[model samples]
Target: YSGSFLYAIIDWSFGQKCNRHRIRTWNAEQRLICDLLDNYQVRWGRPVRNTSEGVEVRFGLQLIHISDLDEKNQVLITNQWQIYEWEDEALKWNPAHYDNLKDIRLPIKRIWQPDVTLYNYADTRLEEKRDVLAIVYHNGTVLWKPMSIFKSTCQIDIRRFPYDRQNCSMKFGTWTYDQSKVDLKFYRDIEKFDLNSYVKSNEWSIIGNRASRFTEKYDCCPEVYVDLKFFISLERRGGFYNYILILPCVLLSCLTCILFWLPPESPSKLVLGMNIFTSFFVLLLLLYKNMPSNAEHIPRIGAYYCLNMGMIATSTFLCTIVVHIYFRGSGPMPVVFRKVFLEWLATLFFMVPHTNTPEHHESYSLIPPNKAVCGGDKFEKFELLKERFKSLGDKHLRTTNNDPNDENIELTIEHECGQSIEDPLS
Candidate 1:
């Protein structure tokens, strides 16, 4: 009968497992796989805990496990406190014991992460008694899932919220002060129990909801309406801001171009060149100071440095041309040569047309015209002399014709070279 009773008990336990539909439900099967303490014993003990006074205390629970039984009648016991509850009547219970009461699997059913806020002990005058923070879990329903569970302005009561504050004081924490009656510093923990991470996720959410959502209600029906909004913007890449630094580099690069216009022979060209080089170095140092050292590739600003160097190189070339011409010393140039050279240089520089013509050549002669033979007065005098000579010859012929009253025949000297005798008196 005892054996039969034992068999019946086993059958009942199996039946209870089947009723839960372990085979039909995948979740049940998964839960069954981890159900090592189905009838386990619970143990109570004290773990080291820190108090507000910075002192450590021993407090814990002890448990004995009873559920790990197999068909072979092998029973295993575990000391882990799988199922334990606090009895407030046991005055030994500290407020910190509430941390161990979390539902490890409750996160799956929550629409949003669970959060806790505590009631102000000072205001309620229940400093250590009723200052319990209530846990809020967003209910994921068909209608609520589509909406933001934690929005810019969602309902949250400070009376039961838990916050984690680490290095940042600007965020909300469990130890914040409501110094200003009008406003209070809100604290929030990134995770449930971590004290190192703080978040300011709710402040702007409250302000944003006031502007909109005149009549929107949340699950808890909180007194204050808060709409959810993301206060801080996401971090953006700074490649464009890095690109902005190029402007100064370009301006400095342009300064090197001034060296080109400086008179080649003047001392200013070398001085300007050195100054430009110095500026390039200075800019390089500034860029280095602003940027991280040990970089492999050059930044966009470095390209400006390279470009300025190119300008300096071009200036150096121009200086070389100036020096070459100055040292050649071709002596004082003739007017014609100077004109031609200037015209060629201008044509080369300005691309003008050459206008020198042959008549304008320097080697052409300069002389006055010989017009004596072609003069009008000289020809008239010569004709008169000829007429006088002919008249004298005729008078000589008349005297020889024997006119006694006529002047005596004064033969000057008749020298006959080749003249005929008949032509003497006719």
Candidate 2:
């Protein structure tokens, strides 16, 4: 039985070996192709010609993801498309089965690639380099896709803030070569830069994109340098700040109006006014902390904070004056003050007068004589003493009429007896 089993295994092994012959190992084929092209000299520029036409390096960018937009550092993290394609005569292949070999992945060092760099980069660290996938055709056309992460500088304008929109650009150009050696151009005729492939960001929304190419000429060299510019329009997601920062500030600002409704005589009115003012000051500090420290342009929200703080300060000052006036019992009410603040302004603001009650009316009638009724000069000493005595007698009569206690009635009888005796003696 063991001998028969060994014979059957040998037959199956031989049959499977014949079937394995038909299968091709792509890894071994790729190694063979690499060895063939290892000795090829890859030229980094155009074929030498007397004409001005230079090597046209086609460039394009496909935004994949937005890692971050650091407003504080003025930097941005973007995973983007970096496609560099220029005709390479040394890198061409003719696979026996052309239809089966669509593309190949090879170490980028084996072929020539442009030394393109972001001119506005904020970080000095080199981007991570890896093997690039290349598509080889019957002709010598080689399409290369290199992995890249762009950390570029962007000037952020946060004046509008929450509702602000930013137009940032990533500029690509050859590091050392000018237009005479190599020129850059967009990949193809792209009507609108598509963003459907990009990962959506929670903090910002991509609105639109545009691609443009321009050349810069310097006075020192007649050679023109070409740059391919990619413009990305971004609008801030305002829902967060609208509810967290703006709405609270607006509500606190509106609360200052309620101070007017509080009775001026209550100590709580002053306490509440102070508390509101303190809150306004704290909100202003928070606004300053969140804003960039640029003196050239102030944000509109900052202006609103300033205005609100000014209003709060003004209200506080007026509240102090109102409390003083409400409790002031020693000094005479100035005639001008009585006419303006007590009559016209009070009525206009719907503030009910305290002098309407019977007790208050009696006290109001005892107001000190106006200086205008004294012939526009200081009163004579004799007349001043006479007016003082008359005021004292009026106050005594009002007190006796309001109180009917036994002490007040006895005092009144004693005053009558003394007056009768003094009258006969005089």
Candidate 3:
């Protein structure tokens, strides 16, 4: 039953108004509400005349904002609006009866709505119908739009890391009903989603997206289940990482180039190499700590760090060897070693001879005033590098030993100019 005396007054006033909006007085709206709910045939369960002909629920989603995507937990949390539209002939009415009332909003609880849910939900809260309004049109059509925060499980592949792209899917299907009871499909009339309403995410960007309808039969149940899957291709926003992570890693890796330029015997070479290696280790540790522990594939940035760390370790080891050999007392340089390394390699590297003080020139010099040391020299006297060392041993020993004319000298000592002969390590 509708309202009494007040309904009569409102019904009379509604007939006097010609305005489209004013046509629906309190009486008109209340009469429609009473006619729809007061019917004993209307029930709360499924609003359909026959169970054999299933009601098709045209459902879609509008992504408003990306709240967060947790890599470790492999969950994608999104803020979205759910859209559903279906026909219920049981709720249809004539617009002429209610002063051309085409549409009316009623409590969503008073109607039958699909129990669509994310099958792989990650949140603790269960999916439930919200207390809102569903628009009921005179043509036996209903439209329900509700905002929801969905935490759906998504597989996260971090193999590419900062440059990686991820494909995350949100699977929506009926929680209990089978395809025979409730069929799901995309709405062709409405724009799939509002692109203008989407807020730009700080860490991820949508590159590609697809919506699909999947129908499958479970092993335990004879009936097939229908679902709509929305796959979103998200590319990580690398601008922040480019500066904070990639740039620093590249700069630290470039520091390894300095090791080759340093002197072979200098201790700083090994020290610098070790320092760069330590930096790489620290970076790797930080990346590992932040990443999912169960990740199967290694990240590109991690591999890059490992490659440089290996180089630094190898170079540091070689540097240690070179410094060790430089300080070792290996008697005199071998004839072949001296010819290849001291003369050929040194000249090829643009190495210049170490200048000696005027006092020590006499000790190492052989045919000093005018000498041809190599093939293209114009000096008149030709003397090889070996002759200079022989002369230093035979000539300087006698001079330093204070023997002017020692004919039967049994020993010879060789040394560089101005260096102390007493300390061997120095």
Clashes of each: 45, 0, 0
**How would you encode candidate 3's per-residue C-alpha lDDT over 145-201 as one tens digit per residue?**
888888988888998898889888888899888998899988763424445579999
Q: Order the numbered candidates by lDDT, best leading.
A: 3, 2, 1
- Cα error of candidate 3 at position 9, Å: 28
Candidate order by decreasing TM-score: 3, 2, 1
lDDT values, one for every candidate: 0.29, 0.61, 0.69
Range of the 10 consecutive residues with the lowest summed lDDT in candidate 3: 410-419
Preferred candidate (TM-score higher): 2 or 3: 3
Model 1 scores worst on lDDT over the 10 consecutive residues at 411-420
How big is the positional error of residue 16 in model 3, measured in Å on the Cα after superposition? 32
> How high a TM-score does candidate 1 get?
0.27
Residue-level lDDT tens digits of model 1 in 320-421:
554444344323434553454344543444423322222211111111111211111222223433343355544444334344322111110010100111
Regarding lDDT, does 1 or 2 come out ahead? 2
> What is the C-alpha local distance difference test score of candidate 3?
0.69
lDDT of 2: 0.61
Candidate 2 to truth, TM: 0.69
